[model samples]
Target: MKQVVAVTSKAQLEAFIDFPHDLYENDPCYVPELFIAQRDLLTPGKHPFHDHSPVQLFLAYDNGKVAGRIAAIFNKNHNAFNNTTDGFFGFFDCVNDKEISSMLFSKAEQWLKEQGATSIVGPANFSTNETCGLLVKGFDTPPFAMMPYNKAYYESLIGNVGLHKKVDLIAYRFGEDGYDDKSVRLKEAIVNRLKTKGIVIRPVVKKNFQAEVDKIREVYNSAWDRNLGFVPMTHKEFDYLAKDLKMILDTDFCLVAEKDGKLVGFALAIPDINQILINIRRGRLLPFGLFKLLFGMKKINGIRVIALGVVEGYRKLGIEACLYASIIEAYRKKKYKHCEASWILEHNELMNKALEHVKGVPHKRYRIFEKAI
Candidate 1:
């Protein structure tokens, strides 16, 4: 018999967080997320998202043994922004059993239904702004930082339960020696031309990060408005994310294009810290794990270009090309071996073309699934 139980105690929640470690213990490519980070994000008072939204976690047990876990999320900001009442399921992991999968989805759907949600969609740890999507292709390598990964059989498991494809997110890879250098070669000329309009490209000012983040926030909120499933992040939410990324942010790859000191565009890439986290048993940062993370930063050989955007009025000014080229140039200078520009909406032709022009190979595809509640 299988039963789904809502996480109500600290011990149960801890078990929920640790389930994947045990599930994928033998999978060499599996990378466990940091236990502390996951704990804080799941706790109501610890993360700012909980202030305006509701998320419920669940655990499934077959008799006395754990079988799966899922999070039922009601993102108020997302609903209000997109004008749709949709709930989401994230942090989803389960054994290869149809009965257990159905039980988990049933529990999540019932919770969302009571919340007045008309539809449920995801695998989105929390929201699309965070780590979302289920890997449907490319199971050979581990995911880059902040990306999601799962067994190839997950597609059938979720599909059998009635979640249909909503959209596919693409991940492109650029090897250190394989990318087209045209963008890099043209970057200098583009910057010179932008200078005629009082625009200039510069790296992020680490000493003045708060001020820089404020400027970039405006552009970020406006630029990605049209993207699929995007919702403008609240001030508190963006600040929280900025603080988290600041720890791994390298100024060399965090560039901004400014017109008289007003940020109109930006791009940010982070070291593939998953290389280090993959070895941290059960995602614990204990006596030895802390040391591995501290010294692993210098050994990472890849970067994940997590974000790149330009405000509406600044689009088509070659800012996007310049930002990407600048990063590639930096990648070469630093001798990083690989880079992944990812989670791009499949319908985003302009950005997709730009990456294709750079010889980026479309290596992985992730799908977001939806089902009416």
Candidate 2:
């Protein structure tokens, strides 16, 4: 017999977090998320998102063995922002059995319907602002930092539940030797041109990070407003995320463009810590896990250009190219081998073209799915 149980106890919650470790045990490409981080993120008071939204975690068991897990999320902010009754399912993992997959979806759908939700959308662990989407097209390589990955069959399982494609997010790769020096020369001219307007690009200052972050928050909220599934992050939420990123933020790769003392653009890149995390063993940091993380930092060879934003008023001023050029320049100086600029909207031609201008090649793709209740 199969049964779906609400994760109401600590032991069950731990099991929920540990399920993926076993599910992907033999999959060489699987990179486990850190256990402690996952616990804190899902905990009510630990993450700021819980302050405004409600989430329920579930574990699916069959014949007394764990079969799957899912999170039923009721995003109050998303509903209020978009003025629609929508729910989300995230942190999803399952065995190959169709029955177990169906049971998990049924439990999530039931919970959302009880909350008066009219549609269910995701694979989003929390939201688009967080890690969302399923690896539908790219499975040969491990995922980049903060990206999602799953077995290819998981795509069929999701489709079996009637969740069709909502959108596809793209990831592009750039090799250290691949960028066109012509583009670099053009970017120099662009930077000089912008300087005439009192606009200059500089690295993020660690000492005055709070002020920089405040400016970034303003630009981030406004820049991505029109993206599909984007919901502006609250002040607290942005601050919370910024604090976490600051721990691994490399100043060389984190740059900002300012014009007349007003922040108009920013780009953030982080060392590809997945190179270290892959060895962390189910994302644990205790009992030798911390040693791997601490020592492995020095060996990381790649970067993930996770965010790049330019304000609406500042578009076409070459700020975007400058940000890309700066990152590439830093990567060259640091002797990094490659970088990934990721989770770009498939339809975002402007940004896509900007990446191609720097010789970025499309390497991986992810998809978000939605279905009417």
Candidate 3:
């Protein structure tokens, strides 16, 4: 018989985290997440996300064999910031059976209803601040570091369940001969003009990394405030994120714009460690897996332009273009083959145009879906 159960015990939670590895075992494109990192992110007391939000994990089984898993989320911060009673479903992976799919959604919907949620939305692991979204297109390649990827049938499964698209997210690729260096040629002029206004762009200083993180957190929260599904991250949450990103961050690609010593904007890109991660079996780092991770950095050929934002007053002054140019200059100098600038909202005209100006093309699409509870 088919069955679905709450992941309540240590063993069950392990099952929840490992199911995808087995599910995608034969798929060449599947990239296993680090088992330990996922464990902490899902465990309540271990991550700062748990300090304010509640999440539950569920697993579906067929004759005791794990068939699928999902996380139900009720983000108090998201609701408070957006002023709505919204619930979310995330970490979703399932087999192709309609009955099993319906069973999983029913269980999640039942739990969300009890929490007073008026709508259920996502594929968000916890929130958009994390890896969220259902891959509706672009399954030909492995995901960039920190981006979501899933079976193509996922879209059908979700649509069959009455969920409708909430929004689409775009990922752009700058391939060989694809980068337009017009901005780089014009960067000096832009910087000179901005300097006349007391603004300058520079790389982040490693000595004051903590202080820099604090400043960037302010810019991050303010710059993306008007974005859909946005909520201001708490100090603890921002710190947690900064520490995690620091591991793969290249200081040169992390640029900041300042006006008289205060940050007004920033851009962050990291080496696509997925190049190495994809080779590490089952996302483990022990018993020779550690060697691969330690020796793999030199082989990575791409970078992910994960974030680029400017505070309100800093926009439209060519800061965004200059940030793109700075990163492109570094990318070329490092001899990286390509870069992926991702998760831009489909309607975000300013960002879309800025990226396109440098010959970036949308190479993938991810979607968030919602259903009334």
lDDT against the true structure, each candidate: 0.93, 0.90, 0.91
Q: Which pairs of residues have clashing backbones in candidate 3?
A: none
> Where's the lowest-lDDT run of ten residues in candidate 3?
350-359
- For residues 109-135, write the lDDT of model 3, one tens digit per residue: 888888889999998988888998898
Candidate 2 or 1, higher TM-score: 1
TM-score of 3: 0.98
Order of candidate numbers by lDDT, starting with the best: 1, 3, 2
Q: What residue pairs are clashing in model 2?
A: 34-283, 35-283
TM-score for model 2? 0.98
TM-score for every candidate vs. truth? Answer: 0.99, 0.98, 0.98
Shift of residue 44 alpha carbon in model 2, Å = 0.3
